[model samples]
Target: KDTHDSLRDENVSIKKSYQDLSMTKASNSNVSSRAVVPEKPKVLAPGLYAMTPKYVPP
Candidate 1:
């Protein structure tokens, strides 16, 4: 359950980031703005996450 919750949060974060990227891409004017794209979150080792919270429910 904890893993599932963590994954869900990560997925939501990625989705929101993608949405933001799309909005920025649409409104950006300069052709060189492609370099401004946000970097993706890095994946850590198994049972650990780079972005996910560490709280677990009993």
Candidate 2:
């Protein structure tokens, strides 16, 4: 009975720690999207349209 109780307690603690780890990962991703992600600008592929008249094929 004592072993079973101890095992259950350990299991609960491990589960709580795992939950915390996953939460931390989610928080990290949120922070990255909010801050670090914008630092690296997205390079949009060139389209057929141009912004100005001078944008012509060489």
Candidate 3:
């Protein structure tokens, strides 16, 4: 009976760690994806608009 109780405690601890790890990974991915998305529009908009003024006379 004692061994069974110990095994149950270990199982609960492992599950808790796994949940925490998954949450961390999910949050990190969200942050990275958000960071990459804003940069793309900033770069494209400036490059395209800056050339428009020069090309307008031709």
- Give all candidates' CA lDDT scores: 0.62, 0.61, 0.60
Q: Tens digits of per-residue lDDT for model 1 on 3-25? A: 99999999999999999999887
Off by over 4 Å in 3: 32-58
Best by lDDT: 1
Q: Rank the candidates by TM-score, best first.
A: 3, 2, 1
Q: After superposition, how far is residue 50 of candidate 1 from its true place, in Å?
A: 46
Q: Tell me the tens digit of each residue's lDDT in model 3 across 1-58.
A: 9999999999999999999999998776654342223332434554453233223231
Ranking by lDDT: 1, 2, 3
Q: Pick the candidate with the highest TM-score.
A: 3
Q: Give the TM-score (vs. native) of candidate 1.
A: 0.48
In order of appearance, the predictions have TM-scores of: 0.48, 0.51, 0.52
Task: Name the weakest run of 10 consecutive residues (lDDT summed) in model 3.
Answer: 49-58
Candidate 2 lDDT, tens digit per residue, 1-58? 9999999999999999999999988766654342222333454665323234323222
Error in Å for residue 58 of model 2: 38
